[model samples]
Target: MAAPHDVPSAAQLVAAVRDFLADDVLPAVEGRVRFHTRVAINVLGMVEREIELGPAQAAEHERRLAGLGVADDAELAAAVREGRFDDSALVEALRDAVGAKLEVANPGYLGDG
Candidate 1:
């Protein structure tokens, strides 16, 4: 008995479809609509993912900064508005804030790190 090869693999079909969409369909489309649509869809997907995870991430960051005994939210907010954290302690505070955010919000989301 021999294995049949009538069907294409999913990866092969997807690649073929993408190539067709890009080289044939997209080029035939008028104006910047297609280009903008593609960008908008991509950005919307990213925003959706961020919205789902941003809050927990922010909370974790706040907790870490609080642990570091850094300045309160009002102070951080003011510094951010002024476009600088300035001091080394402040920088470390920001680092810890971000690290904790990533750690909790996406722990294991980074893959083996």
Candidate 2:
């Protein structure tokens, strides 16, 4: 006997299946490879997202700062790497970069909503 809230929804079941594909299926195929393969895959996915979004975000920051006219690519790159950009600029940059990169869409990212 379970409460209504305790029941797993269809979305949760689907999510569990998706997690299994990533955490179990992919790693299992590597055969004798250690768990580090899965770990590496996960890390690589994160890096890919960063690469896709990071530049566009920086470009947006540069665009916004077109008003202040203090934007430079080299300085922006340095700031991004060192994480020293102004707060608003950083947020805008990240949003733009992520939006741009996300356009291509990754297959591994299994979600519709």
Candidate 3:
């Protein structure tokens, strides 16, 4: 998608700030400032991941929900609680959906880093 405004689109601007916080601000800060900087950096990282993966994740989530005979996560959860489907495939699909979420939220948890 072409940016009609100018150079440095929103994602670019976010990336720049995130990088600055990680590379410069983080190094100089201490105690609460450092902790908050880390949190801010993580939030920025999640934002970047969502910007990159949110659409694909949404489509995959919908597809997985349909495969499990549910329209959304709530329905899926209800079905799971009710034991409507007892199959490894359902479990695997749910696992994959969660894995996708973790990938966006914290990829390091899966040792992706």
User: Would you list the clashing residue pairs of candidate 1?
Assistant: none
Query: Whose lDDT is higher: candidate 1's or candidate 3's?
Result: 3
lDDT of 3 by residue, 1-113 (tens): 35476776666777888999999999999999999999999999899888778888999889988888899888887988898996897888978988999989999888833
Candidate 1: TM-score? 0.41
Model 3 TM-score relative to the real fold: 0.88
Give the TM-score comparing model 2 with the true structure, all chains together: 0.31
Worst 10 residues of 2 by lDDT: 104-113
Count of clashes in candidate 1: 0
Pairs with steric clashes in candidate 3: none
Candidate 1 residue-wise lDDT at 109: 52
Instruction: Write one digit per residue (lDDT tens) for candidate 1, span 10-58.
Output: 4344445555656676667767878864554444444544555567777
Task: List residue ranges in candidate 3 displaced over 4 A.
Answer: 2-7
Write candidate 2's Cα lDDT for 5-51 as tens digits.
Answer: 55464435444555665778776676545455566555555555554
Estimated TM-score per prediction?
Answer: 0.41, 0.31, 0.88
Using lDDT as the measure, what is the rank order of every candidate, best first? 3, 1, 2
Please report how far candidate 2 places residue 112 from its true position, in Å. Answer: 16
- The positional error of residue 90 in candidate 2, measured at the CA in angstroms, is 9.0
